[model samples]
Every structure is written in C-alpha cells, then in structure tokens.
Target: MPSKLTTVLAVGGVAVITSNPGSGMHALVQEHQMGILIEAENQQALNDGIAAAMSQDTTQFSQNARRYAEQHLSLEGVMRGYEQLLLTC
Candidate 1:
C-alpha cells in the first residue's frame, strides 16, 4: 500500500499519483484509482496504462468532456471556460 500521506490529485478524472515506474496501470485498475500515475518506466507502459484506464470507464473519462465542451468543443465561452479551469488548477 502507498503511504497514508500520499496525495492523489484528480486532474480531469486522471489520478495523478507518485509511485514507482510501471506501477500506474495496476494502481489505476487494481486500486480503482484512475488518471495518470506519476512515474512510468517507459512510454509503452504509460500508453498501455492509459488505454487500460480509458477502457475501464469511458464515462468517467468523459467527466472532462463537459469541461472541454465548455472550453474548446464550441466557440462561445471557450476561452472564458478555459481560463476559469486554468485558474482553478
């Protein structure tokens, strides 16, 4: 298990965590923690982990869809929405 003090940040439903390389995918699925892991051993592992995480719950991934829509998927309010999201981030 990771440290109790370990912080998991959800950036667009992607769980940003600090862990050893090649441990992201497992954590995402096995630990039910989605998003990206901090340390990926390689590009391939990162890609595979992303694919696995995406397949696990496209809907959950879609959580950011609204943000995208409010920001870029359309013309009006796109920049404003983006600025707001960025400010929050």
Candidate 2:
C-alpha cells in the first residue's frame, strides 16, 4: 500500500527516464495510465519530455492520478488484482 507521503508528495503524476525501456514497472506504469516515459539515452528528448511533463501539472492530471491510484494502485486495488490473478491460477 502507498503511504500518505507517496500520495501527498506526488503532484506531478509519474515518469521515468531509463535505459531499460519495457520492463515490468514501465509496463505497469503505462498500464495504470500514470505518466509519461522518457528514454535515458537521449538528453534532448529527455529534457523535452521532462518539460512537457512539468507543464502538465494541472488539476486534471491530479484527478486522473488519484483515480488511477484508487482503481489500480491502492490497497483495495492491489488486493483486487491479486485476487483476480489467484482465481485465474
């Protein structure tokens, strides 16, 4: 479960600049509709992506992030996903 700090501190949605492109965490972040992705290999692209992400610090993003967390990242959300996975197995 995400702590209060995680919820309160995260105002800029989510993003990661990494060389490992399509890892599990990246996929999960994308799947949950959290934030943008920037490739670590390209400085110019990363900078532009960061600028874009920074510019999108709006109420809509917050609302969407909160909704996504509630639907897929919260304790209940995690438990629900886990339960569904268990049933399939």
Candidate 3:
C-alpha cells in the first residue's frame, strides 16, 4: 500500500501525487477519484495539478477517501482480516 497516499485519504485530505511508473498512484487516484496525479518531475504538471485541486469542488473526493479508509484501512477491517487468516490457519 502507498502509505502517504493512505494517510492523506484516511484523513479525508486530497493528495497531489506524482505519476511514477509502477507506483500505482495513478490507479488509486483514478479508481477512487480521490486526488490529482501529475507527471513525475514535471514542474508544469505539478503546478497544474495544484491549481486543479484548489479550483475543484472536493466534496466527492473527500467522501470517497473517507469511505475507502473506513472500508479498507480501519482497525476493524484489519482485525477481520487477521481473524480470517487465523481461522484458515
């Protein structure tokens, strides 16, 4: 998991991340509609991403992020996963 991305999402904050190859950041942002993904090492892209993030209405993004966190990253979810693992073991 992308720890920094998860942290931002868990707190309902929008992330502006670089689209690094093999990083999965793009996929996560696209799948969840949670943040802006910019081309890595591109200053223009970074500027544009920040501008877009600031200009856009982020209510949906915030909601999606919080929902993802609760469903996938919460303590309850982790405990359930552990329980399932132990049951199988």
The candidate maximizing lDDT is 3
Q: Against the true structure, what is each candidate's TM-score?
A: 0.31, 0.55, 0.78
After superposition on all CA atoms, what RMSD does each candidate show versus the true structure?
Answer: 11.3, 4.2, 2.3
Show the colliding residue pairs in model 2.
none
By the lDDT metric, which is better: model 1 or model 3? Answer: 3
Between the candidate structures 2 and 3, which one is better when assessed by lDDT?
3
C-alpha lDDT score of every prediction, in listed order = 0.48, 0.61, 0.84
On TM-score, the candidate that comes out on top is 3
Per-residue C-alpha lDDT of model 3 across residues 1-89, encoded as one tens digit per residue: 67887898899998888887566767877788777778999999999989989998888888888888887789997888889999999
Candidate 1 stretches with Cα past 4 Å from truth are 1-41, 79-89
Candidate 3 residue pairs that clash: none
Clashes (N, CA, C under 3 Å) per candidate: 3, 0, 0
Q: What is the lDDT of candidate 2?
A: 0.61
Q: Would you list the rank order by lDDT, best first? A: 3, 2, 1
Q: Rank the candidates by TM-score, best first.
A: 3, 2, 1
True lDDT of residue 58, candidate 1: 51
Flag regions of model 2 displaced more than 4 Å: 1-20, 56-61
